[model samples]
Target: MSSVLLFFQGLEHSPLSVGLRASEWMYPLVNTLHILGIALLVGPILILDWRVLHRRATPPVAALATVLLPVARGGFGLAVVAGSLLFITRPLDYAFNTLFQIKLVCIGLALLNIALLHWSKAWGLAIKDNQFSQSVRLACGLSLVFWLLVLALGRLVGYR
Candidate 1:
């Protein structure tokens, strides 16, 4: 307990500590970029999921993956960079914040969901044939939920 308390104290006193003492606009700028990256990441995933769910379009699964995967990856990469900077500005508070922990867990779950979708033969079939099975639909739904939660949890960092 003492060690943890000391760690937090050190973090609070660190020259890079985030708070009113930090440059006024820097934190918000980083946060804005992080949000934009999240928007980019979620947009394609949502669209692809909707298409798979509704059977509206029939683009080849691999083709769809090719188009969206890079966008999603780029967004993720940007978000990670921005988010790390944000954390660096206030490592101690963020490290202890429950909302931040939840956000990280949600991110992990979202990544796992994406990996599973890519690895599953059914998901490939759905993409290639543009015909999603019940399982694929369920996966899509879960993916949506997980990503949304990640966003919500991120917001909660400010409120809680």
Candidate 2:
């Protein structure tokens, strides 16, 4: 009866949701794309984070970022679009799912970590001088943790 519930109910009954729910192939196709998108997003992130953490073992941070950021951004975009479509199919269910809630939180934190890192002077230090300060290293470590949590929680959201 509340506005939020009403909004979700409306989403659940939308033409797009109804069509996706009734379709035999569309849901599966979107699900596949969501998985692929996560793969693309997480894979680059893992490599980049690891490289940042282990500064001596990889190429320059800027070089790797230049190559990886676009792929990660594309993946994130795809995932969000596909995920939104999937969510609309059962808006209330996802809106209430605790696992889904946690997944969203983890994703937010991961994105925030990225924003903070890029905005801070640590980023330039890491990129130009190959120097990662404690905060930068901690951010990279947290990025890894947050993303992994998001991945696991996403799977659990579907499992439950």
- The TM-score measured for candidate 1 stands at 0.83
Clashes of each: 1, 0
The residue-by-residue lDDT of candidate 1 on 108-159, one tens digit each, is 9889988888899988777666778888888888888888898888888978
In order, candidate lDDTs are: 0.81, 0.93
* Per-model TM values vs. the true structure: 0.83, 0.97
Which residue pairs clash in candidate 1? Answer: 61-127
* Model 1 global lDDT (CA atoms, 0 to 1): 0.81
Question: Which candidate number maximizes TM-score?
Answer: 2
Global Cα RMSD, each model? 2.5, 0.9
Model 1, residue 61: what's the lDDT? 58
Q: State residue 28's C-alpha deviation in candidate 1, in Å.
A: 2.4
| Model 2 agreement with the true structure over 1-160: per-residue lDDT tens digits | 8999999999999999999999999999999999989999999999988988886845888898999999999999999999999999999999999999989999999999999999998798778887898899899999999999999999888988
